[model samples]
Target: MSSIRGARVAALSAVVVAAFALSACSGGATDDPPASAEQTLRLSAQAPPSSWAIGNAPGGDATMYLSVYDTLLRTTPDAEITEGLAEEWEYNDDLTELTLHLREGQEFTDGEPVDADAVVASLNVSREGPSTATNLTAVSDVTATDESTVVLTLSQPDAALLPNLADVAGAIGAPDVLTAESSTLEPVGSGPYILDSSSVAGSNYVLKKNPDNWDADSFPFETVQFQIIADPTAITNAMQAGQLDWIALNTPDQLAQFPEPKYTSGSNNANGLGVLWLADREGTIVPALKDVRVRQAINLAIDRESIAEKLQVGSLHPTEQVVNPNGGAWSDELNETYSYNLEEAKALMAEAGYADGFAVTMPSTFLSTPYEPTFSQQLGDIGIQVTWETVPFQDFLTKVFSQNYGMYFMFNAFRSADSVDVRGATTAIFNPFNSTSPEYEALIAEANSSESADAFAPVNEYFVKEAWFAPIFYTAGPWVASDKVTYTPAKTFYPSLKPWAPAN
Candidate 1:
């Protein structure tokens, strides 16, 4: 199948951790095929979806959403925009208009032709629909130039438009599927793979493969089953018992128990934004947080090394910036500003009249297995009494939307390749904080108005300097492959069996 070739040149699939790979080596085949005629891969994770609704579901559902959907464009493991359903694409000089060239003979699993109109309808639904995760609201109109071509006209130049389109929530579906019922069903896409079957039986889910993929017949595995096993010991037991081949190490103890799984470490963009929200409550410690000294105290107290040593799984990289190190435009200018300094933290606390170090409640989501608990402890060590209120991912979002939490994790899902001036980050937090920063607002406008992406840097610098949002480490997961299963890591997404076979 022909797909966009040029974006691959720019590393379109810029993902923090490039551990997702095909299961085979480059130009090498699995030496010994599995004994079973139909290979069933048992993949395990802590994330289990309550419903497959992209617009409504809380966090922890990205894994399933990504695997079972398709977008017009995708990010490289390194965060570049590569081609997907569209064979080729071009952004106008002003960055306001984008044209995508679709692959010929592409059809959804449900037999609907993957045409330009379908793409337009799918995007429009996400724009006007209840899917808040679909960051394409900036788009004003979408028109099919022809059967194989679609043109997207944004209200303004959105530098991150391509990467935003890569979002799983923005996955294109059959027009009729959206109209069928309010209930969720299998999403129809025109990617190289398809969801053959998915069922949540008890705590486990089974997802098979569609043999009618548009790509070449190189993918070795025929079926992929995702098991939602909660117990770390149970996961280890499954691995030892040969009942499971791939299992995520949820905690440090769990990772220690199973030391042999090949560990792949990288960064992700899910780390919560560093924010100093103005608390609206009548009586609260947050009014003090309005002071820059207090905010600086919070920043200085963060010991990223301890968190890395204690919480980072399978050798994931430690970071101090929200955009991540692998993210091309990530600014290190703020690094010295938020560096770990207990003495400085104490001084700032005293300066803010909190020499006693006030106690505060830190509401967080248990869905983020690595960061929340560690972050709470980091603040606790610096004389700030931190009481963690672990809530579900959905609850966290609602609380944030209401601005009820003094401090919480808000993961900024970037839709475009890492540009220095991040419109999504600004739009997500800035609008809530101070939508009127002429400089910040102007940057967003300028980024869209730039003749090319090269002109976006000047405006992006304002965000990095003003500390509108604190930077945190990238949140990438470990990709461990059994010795028996050798695959190339596809950094842009979760590991798949597409590129591998059984090793001799």
Candidate 2:
């Protein structure tokens, strides 16, 4: 969404796939070092971190970025705001301004002081970055008030700012490293670990403890290695072979094999559950989709429960909304809002004057195909035929935003009301046509106006009733770890290097 026309979208390729679905670095204090600091926290990554640019370490590079850079704030497993690099923080009475006091004696790996000026520089680059720009949408200015003090002026009270800081949007890169010629592939950060020379760019990454880390004792691993394994079978084999402490399990069979007491499982309702996004709400590319009845008809055609039972292996729950059931913005009333009814869908299609059906072109990728068959076939039966133009995984994001397709599939993390708005709002990248009605915009405004999660309840209901997203189900992301590696799954969708402690 940040300057797609600027072609900065090319910078976003590494962060998609498994990386986008993972969220949160839940804030915690390890008062005591792990039982064994000499242990290595070996984990399987679905994708690899390919960039070291500021605010560029989202998606697969999230943990890698977290390892190399320290965010100003940290989020706990509860999704509560806490401290990371900054020891203290405060907001003005109106909540438009925020001040951060960094921890003393901290410096970047390149020997530059981790001061307010460095933070301001990093924030400046991030304000226009592909991912961070959207996160800092409310910030009007960032200033270095003092050596350890940084202040932010906001255009409005952004409820998502604090949590965003805990995520990739908060990563503070060393100014010198950021400007270096090779920094794109090489990083210079002040986090708990540093990238080892033996590390390969895409295959494997080996990180060693930062000799000068301010909170050296806080992290449990002395060394960490992330293996890029794409196949679920390979990840499962790696875990069984003791090559991995945990795995980003993919298939239901993989999840089932890693049974209870021996292996601990953690899951959160991720946004990747085959959400069928109707991008051409204005009917720029597909005229029939412009009609509200046509859109509602599509929602009725999806057999969400079947997708959950047959494809998802009953490990996940089916639904019609994108909100995480555990989050405050979730509403039980909206979950089963659309029941599978082909006849009803046909009637709506006929009422919209498309009784004979219309053909549409759609973008698909390696990641989206598994969920395609049912969605495409169900629509076909109702006279709405889909023509998929499969693109490489790397080209998928750019193709969708190019406005070349009327519909596509997307996977993202559902953290708050802001998360939903970025995709549904008129300005969101997902809404290529920027289509919206006064009533829909009004609900969005009301939701953003209030910090209370309750306000978003209406917005969630509105999208479901309007059939903005034919979300097949409320999907869950499950991780399998050895019993010896116990962990607390934060409200965040992904686990970074911080949570893995050496089991007693």
Clashes of each: 40, 8
lDDT of 1 by residue, 1-504 (tens): 000000010111111111111001011123344444256656655435444443432232244454555667755544456667787998777677888998877777778887888888777767765444336766888899899999989887665566667654456777777545532655565554555445754455555555555542544566666666655456557766667655433333444544554432112223223232323222243565565566667767777656656554433334444453434445556455667888988898898788877677656543343466666676766667767677654455465556555555443322234442254454433333433356657766765565463455555455444444444444333333455554443333322244345433
- For model 2, how does the per-residue alpha-carbon lDDT over 1-504 read when each residue is reduced to its tens digit? 100000111111213543343222221234465567787777756566646788665452366677888888876655567788889999888778999999989989889898899889888888888766777888999999889999999987766778777767788888976656677778888888998899988888899999687877778788888777755567668787778776544334656777777787665334233467887988898888788899999999988778777765634467677666666766777776678999999999999999999998877776567777877899998988888887876777577668888877665444533443333233445676777889876776666557685666776787888887777654444566777665544443333455567777
Measured by TM-score, the strongest candidate is 2
User: In candidate 2, where is summed lDDT lowest over 10 consecutive residues?
Assistant: 2-11
- Misplaced by over 4 Å in model 2 are 1-33, 251-272, 416-429
CA lDDT for candidate 1: 0.50
| Residue 22 lDDT in candidate 1 | 5
| Candidate 2 structure, TM-score to reference | 0.89
Q: What range of 10 consecutive residues in model 1 has the weakest lDDT sum?
A: 1-10
Give the Cα-based TM-score of candidate 1 against the true structure: 0.75
